[model samples]
Target chain A: MEEKLLSGAELVIRGLEHLKVSTIFGVPGGAILPAYDPLYDSPIRHILARHEQGSGHMAEGYAQATGELGVVIATSGPGATNLITSLNNALMDSTPLLAITGQVATEAIGNDAFQEAYTVGLTMAATKHNYLITDASEIPQVLLEAKHIATTGRPGPVLVDIPKDILNQKAKWIEPKLVDLPGYKPTLDANPKMIQQAVNLIKDSKKPLLYVGGGIIHSKANIELFDLAQKFNIPVVTTLMGRGAFPDGHELCLGMPGMHGNYTATTSIQNSDLLIAIGVRFDDRVTANPKFFAQNAKVIHADIDPAEIGKVRDAEVPIVGDAKSVIKGLIDKLGDTKLETSNWIQEINEMRESYPLTFTQDEDGPLKVPYVLEELQKMSEDDSIVVSGVGQHQMWISLHWKFTKPNTWLNSGGLGTMGYSLPAAIGAKAAYPDRQVLSLDGDGCFQMTCQELITASTENIPLKIVVFNNGNHGMVRQWQKIFYKNRFSASELTHHTPDYVKLAEAMGAVGLRMEQKSEVKDVFEKMLEINDKPVLVDCVVDPDDMVFPMVPAGGSNDVIILNEEDLKKI
Target chain B: MSERILSVLVEDKPGVLARISSTISRRGFNINSLSVGPTNIDGRSKMTIVTELESVEQVKKQLNKLINVIKIVELDPDNTIESEVLLMKVSINKDSQTSVIEKANLSGAKSVDVGQDYAVFELTGTSKELKKFENLMKPFGIIEMIRGGRIAIQSNL
Candidate 1:
């Protein structure tokens, strides 16, 4: 028999436990202190993050690494406001995240009360859906709805803001079996007419290309995209977020295209006769100049969001439906279409060979970021997840790490939020204890959420955080060196970092530092051997390193700054 | 192509017009036309959007997923009655004020005020009626026009 007595906070915590949430990242404050009081005795582990944003990112990382929704709790006002960046990141990346924040009491709302912010309005754009729970009785339903919206179709973050009074009020906790919202229904089928139209266009084109994005991963349609690509002998180019959909090792995988993408990736799109875009919003980053993005290609943009179908470029055929369904339909209809085995493939191959991702390591200057990623990749499992903090390290991980599954590679794609990796790694490890969860972070991002390392150590979630230390926001410094005429504006950060080994020991975990290129392989081997606790590897890297082949944001995709030009020649 | 109904909730702010219309332009989903109005609450409004999508099933499903949209539902076209409201401000010669007022009343519109040289007329009904009123006042030289967004509700038995 289910008991019916619990405060809103208890209901929320109980519901989370029922939903199998073992860990929650948060910071206690005035409005949310009530919820914290009850959490002390709960089975759910509450991690006290130094900042609310760190907690938000931890939730995001966990959700992105594991398919399970990431849960974060924050107090009202600035705590809630700080979460905006992480929320924005989740929204942009379509990660499954659930963020619950304490709200000022109903009486104090709109009265400009302390620690009060318009969280609902602030998070509306960044969440798939959000609710402000004013009634304590509605807590169960709201929690259910929040998780449902978050994990359902093209997964994304959702928020539920409960006022302090509501959290304090006792209510009958009715754990409903179903959420019946008449207004919410997600479709997973392609529009037949649009599919037919797309099929017809693909059928007519000589050189068709499948431009895949993160949607393929979101829909778990990598097999389908790969099948369609091979079915039609089409080359596949992924956006930055869409990496890992097709292995770079595969000949069919053309590599990432757009600003900062490989030449072949961008050129393939330009030269292709027909472009079939799946589950990707053609952001300005992808299409620096829409006019030239697919100049010679007839575009057929397929996305679940109707508004994004042709938002950036003209679509010869726009299909608004789930990526998996649409791609399946296309594959079904692609029978007997003649394969165009043209030199377009040759051009792509030539570019890939000409501009491959590389880093020199001949007893080289500082530690190499790529070498660190390569070592980690070998040590990690195919199913293990890697989340990245924003900056040079983020770019390097996306470039060098070989991921094999959906949610295996998580990064703040849209918002580019820094300090996201560490906590997210902790969350991911907690969510899926069986899998290895690691945050490949930069020093800049590591410091941003390093306080959560203590959380990781205390919770005993065996998360591995490999911090690529360059002593600066390496990406911004690269930008300054290239674009801003080397005028570094607050791009450098310095604080006496506690000896990380002692720090991890202090926090009840393992910590190792790698100063030389040779030191990394041995240190990483040793770290992997000791899986008893969380580990942090402070990897010293080249300070002036830049993520090369970057077609400056808003610049032409075909135009790239070669790594040689940026590093060796310059 | 099939048709679908969508309910879009937007921040009731200026230039939301440009955002909505521009979205339509980008998507190229033919708008059969839509009706909108303010809701019971302030600073929030709803739109009853009717559009010809390639697939009714797909459109209905996708409409529910938009992050900016607060809520969406397919109105049973068989049972729901929809309407649009329109408002206009016209500057007419002082001598033609009486004629304009008479014309306004004939079009089921009320000339709510008489200014030094202009009159603001308000009308609530179908878009056809509003268009008719606009055409009737065309000779008087319309100075400004405002059309409320689309809103709809199911008629009770």
Candidate 2:
């Protein structure tokens, strides 16, 4: 708060501390080494990650769990480029992530010096906003502006590329203030007139369904969504990103709807007369051949980002606003009115009964992946945060887990990045040490970023991680089995090299292996009991088993493949 | 394709141009012509982009999402004063020199340079007029030609 001379690196650490940032994730290198010197003395705790990408996802995990800005730092060139995946992941999922990279000195920037990269150029499309700083005097304001931009109004990733010279430049320090961004104002509240029109459409519809997405969790509108659905007794179907936005076991909830969505959820979407979409982009995974998706439904789309409205499915009534404000507006304007959705609800319930999500567990066969998911969720507390990696296990968690609280379910939804579970779960545990954190990942996805388990162990962040090891890339084999005439090429994951139990022990974490379905409950119980360090469980299973109730790509929601029987019929 | 001109105002900063152009291209919209210049307002710039994509509304909305983009408006061709500068060099001898100069004068073009075997002329007008002049010089075997892309501003009534 005083006017004092400070180096650029000190200014950065001081500025972050001034902004109330207590934790950060990063990897140090030549360009970023100067910033690390100041960070050494700062009160902020910087978790050293093995890879820059890991640090970025850890930031994303922290941001999503706490509803705050997740910060990650790296050096230039390869270090900065490695962060592209995590930055893009945050961009797609709308997580507030701030990425700071150290560049070469100003004189060496254009000379192709060692570790110099055009980071700002490379990350232009990968971030929500970005900046390149060569002057030390701009550090304070740029730091403040970067955090503000990354955290507000349709949150996404922002980056600041600072030259190494700037990190050593001495400059007068002043308390940075947030200047209004004229071009960056976001629409928070929809027009009342538009809300009235949406209300009118809900009143006239014979069958109305609430289609929720991750935006509901981002906007903290779960209660409003539930109240609105309960008032009308409307059916609710959540997307993969919207898994925890609504309780899965509610009488009106039809579970997830999309390519791998439940049969009832998909059918209800096709048969609905009205679809009230909230905080969703109508991603192709959900819409599936947009022309044929929800043919009988008129859509009312609401989201914080205006560009998302009608981007995929044309919305008859577009409400451009945050989910909480729009849903609250709809609730207040509709004013305790109950709709006649009893017959509609009964029709969907019949469909739900005819085709529930089911898989047979053989007496002496390979461990079922879904069984592991259920056991983990059943053993853990209801409020335990769930994280997942991209593959069959990710879909299994979505299909099996019953999330009762918002922000409790985390995964790489839009980007679908593999190996996201371990570091992200560590991030969640870092944000909320009191809450239990469990991550479900596949054999293929777990190896991609499994090195981060060392960070968890060394940092003393205890996380229960389960790897459903089918000894191959499970999802690809399933697609090959169904569509590629059973020719499994490059799918075996090198015959499961590098024993996972040893890998866990080498990483300073407890290792548990589940080779049978009978060991699931005990393995999970023991995994939960360990609180001193992270624990990894490898549940070996059958590779032939695949995710069912799937609508093939470019197929209509009306056409769903129930099981191998349906595929054989094809 | 029905063509539309989008006039966009953006903050004067590095990488803003790349952001706008990339956003347009990634949306699968092809730009016909784009020109940028400093505006009267400090720390702000304006870009004139001509595209014939099916949905100008889609591109406009996408650009608005960029943090550097201040505002965007589609200019009405009827009320816009669109113009460009054209320079043309023609191969000419003693016989054709007089005739080329005559024709250039008829179109209000000024002869900027004259060589023993070639003549250079300069003109300013809308694309339609400059295109007509290009054709006229083609008969004389145009040696070279250059034209500044179109720029427009609304006519204040």
**Top of the candidates by DockQ:** 2
Worst 10 residues of 2 chain A by lDDT: A490-499
Q: What would the per-residue lDDT of candidate 1 be over residues A297-368, giving only the tens digit for each residue? A: 898988876656655676889886788899889888777777665676786777678877777765856767
Residue B106 shift from truth in candidate 2, angstroms = 3.3
- CA lDDT for candidate 1: 0.77
List, residue by residue over A417-526, the lDDT tens digit for candidate 2.
99888888888889999899988888888889999999999999988888888888999999889889989988888425768889999999999898887888888888
TM-score of chain A of each: 0.92, 0.98
Instruction: For each candidate, report what fraction of the true interface contacts it reproduces.
Output: 0.17, 0.60
The residue ranges of model 1 lying beyond 4 angstroms of the native Cα positions read A1-5, A17-22, A33-45, A175-180, A336-338, A494-508, A564-570, B1-157
lDDT of 1 at A421: 83
TM-score of candidate 2 on Cα atoms, chains taken together: 0.97
